[model samples]
Target: MSLSAPVLAFEENSGLDTAESAASCALKLVRHDALSKADLSAIEQLAHQPAARHSGNVFFAPRAVAASASLSRGSIDWLLWFQDGRLCLAAPVVISRIASFSLVRIWTHTYAPLGTPLADKRLRPDLLFEELADRGFSALACPLLETGSTLATAVALPGGRQDGRAGFWSGIAERAVLTSDWTEAAALSAQRKKKLRKMQRTLPLVHRVLRGDAARDEGFRQFCELEAMGWKGAAGSALKQSDTALAYASELVASHGAQDTLAIDSLEDPQRQGNQSVAMVISFEIAGRGVVWKIGHNTDYDAVSPGYQVILAASRRFAAENTPIWIDSLAGPEHPLVGWLWPQRLTVGTLVVPLKGSHAPARTLSGFYQAEARLRQVARALRQRLRR
Candidate 1:
């Protein structure tokens, strides 16, 4: 699973040839520690500034914190910096090996929804993918990518096709821009404005979103309780109680806190008196990018649309800061929330590549793909039947 010298050379040699002026920047692969604290801080600061692209929780800074926390089990080999002296590129080439397999996977450190190339929007993926292939990674998976991202546009598989799925989902805010003024943002869209007005009118009826203090030990407990009482518990879902899952959540929050951008918003109302906490949405601010992680709402409060209000409130608050940020709902297109929030799509998918000179790896990948295809077919059929 180790990165060979040839692979590293291939990645370094692949450079962007896009027509954009920003594409002229030379791409460099350096050890994770190559980024000086001052340089990292500068990038962090610039990422938070207005008009900065790809500044979110999953960039280099947060990754540094998360890695230091010892929570991430995977190894972080290098930080891919595509820079031109002053302007910095934020995409880090994270290398990790799959268990029970000899294949190594390379990806943009995009574990969360906010993960994106922290470079100029003009950054090209063709060069990045070429470098990734040259690095000899068996697969390049970019999870939770924004739908219209330049990286997504640039990446092409060996067969000259993109490998990923794009969709929306319910219970989360879609990709959206928070304006400089909350009031102005409220008026930006007539539909959104109308919904906000309605929610505001209904706010008197036991509806309010509360931000919890992560410093308090009870913060995680309260979040878990609300999440359990909402959906996970009733469904007996493993995500509610899984230590691995909880660790990931805690890690992301801690990482965000280190960057001074971690936020937890919970929906509470007296009318929904069964449980004080109806819905909880966890968001991380990394270098100014706002990414909504896990969101859960009590089924009991679903009738009143409490989740939507909480999201709206959070969005308004973010907009008031005048920071260029994106709130990702991180759900499939068919999600109920997509209907109301109308956040733009953030497409994401797992990229799988069969290992060369290894019939075993290729065979294993083929079986996995076949199984996945079957599952997708079944899901599609089920969905079509449900539509009837």
Candidate 2:
């Protein structure tokens, strides 16, 4: 299904209202097809800005993921709101039937770690939820929500109604925003200062930093090589054993590029010769927000902590630009990196609403949600371990 200019068709009684608000206008839900190419381009441009919220989970944020999801059997939709015609909120909604329970389930980029609604920081949760409910969705499921997100707070309110019967999965959303003054970051922690000092001393010994679109291809290869060596090289690891997983990573990288979000910062070791890209950090630039996607280093260089050094360098670059961007190290709270870095935690939650008159049985829906929560718990545990 090639969605090259799809029109958005809303069902009658669809909760969304196109009416503008004087205080905080009504929420608008536009289908993926209804968005114009220019609208997409504008959103993409905002995503790349140094201060915008660039979430990979949003359908329109990265073209590759959006296109791939569109082709899949799963029903994927996009929701957005405009303020005086300016894009304010954007989220990708994936609807699927839980095979065991036969219940309709909706999620945003289930495969990724952080799935926050990409919207203007000023957006209100009540307004957003009212729009969502109007669209005919009874519940919203957000796995890997940060600890204190406005969206999470909104969903847990009276109108939102929390489902206490079904236990929730918890994950940490580690984030730190770069300020105009890079030096202010030093106040964050003594350990951060120590690491910065060590990296500053060691940087001259490693290869130079690779920047911009010109270096992306080579940088991507280095990132993959480092990633493979770090995790996939381990026995029975998913990345090593699953071709689909590898393809997924490659697809994300490719799609980010097609959508102009791919950003790489790498360090080569000139002292050690021949075809080895020792340390690399891959990040996606969205809405001026820098999301740290992945980082890897040659274990051989563990003594020097090359991976840590690469990240420090990248952070400094953003700081130097004086950009109000957050380095979203989207990891679980238990992860050592998250704890040590001490990034702010934002909470997110899943909202499940039962379609009142669906043909599907209720028992089926209950079982599906149960299984979903369990699966989420397992995934969270594994992710926490990886951060260590």
Q: Which candidate wins on TM-score?
A: 2
* lDDT for position 223 in model 2: 69
Candidate 1 residue lDDT tens string, 1-388 = 1111111111122443444434554445454556667556756665665534443334345454344333345545444445454444454445566654544333332234344455555444445444444556554433434434444433433443323311111111234344333344534488766765776576543434333345223445566777787545765642457665666566555555665566666666666544476666666554455556666677665656767766665666666553655555555555555433543554443333333333344334444544554575578578656644
TM-score of each candidate? Answer: 0.60, 0.66
Candidate 2 lDDT tens digits, 1-388: 1112111111222254535342445454445556677667656654544324433333335444454464446655665565555665566566554443322233344335465555554444445444555555544455554434434433344443343222233222234434344443653477767776785577544545554544456677666667777744663453435565555566667767665666677777666677456777777665455467777778787767777667666776666653555556655455544334434543444334333333233334434545665687797688657756
| Candidate 2: residue 138 Cα off by (Å) | 2.3
Model 1 vs. true fold: TM: 0.60
Off by over 4 Å in 2: 1-39, 45-62, 67-73, 81-87, 97-111, 120-135, 146-204, 235-243, 258-261, 351-388
Error of 1 at 387 (Å): 15
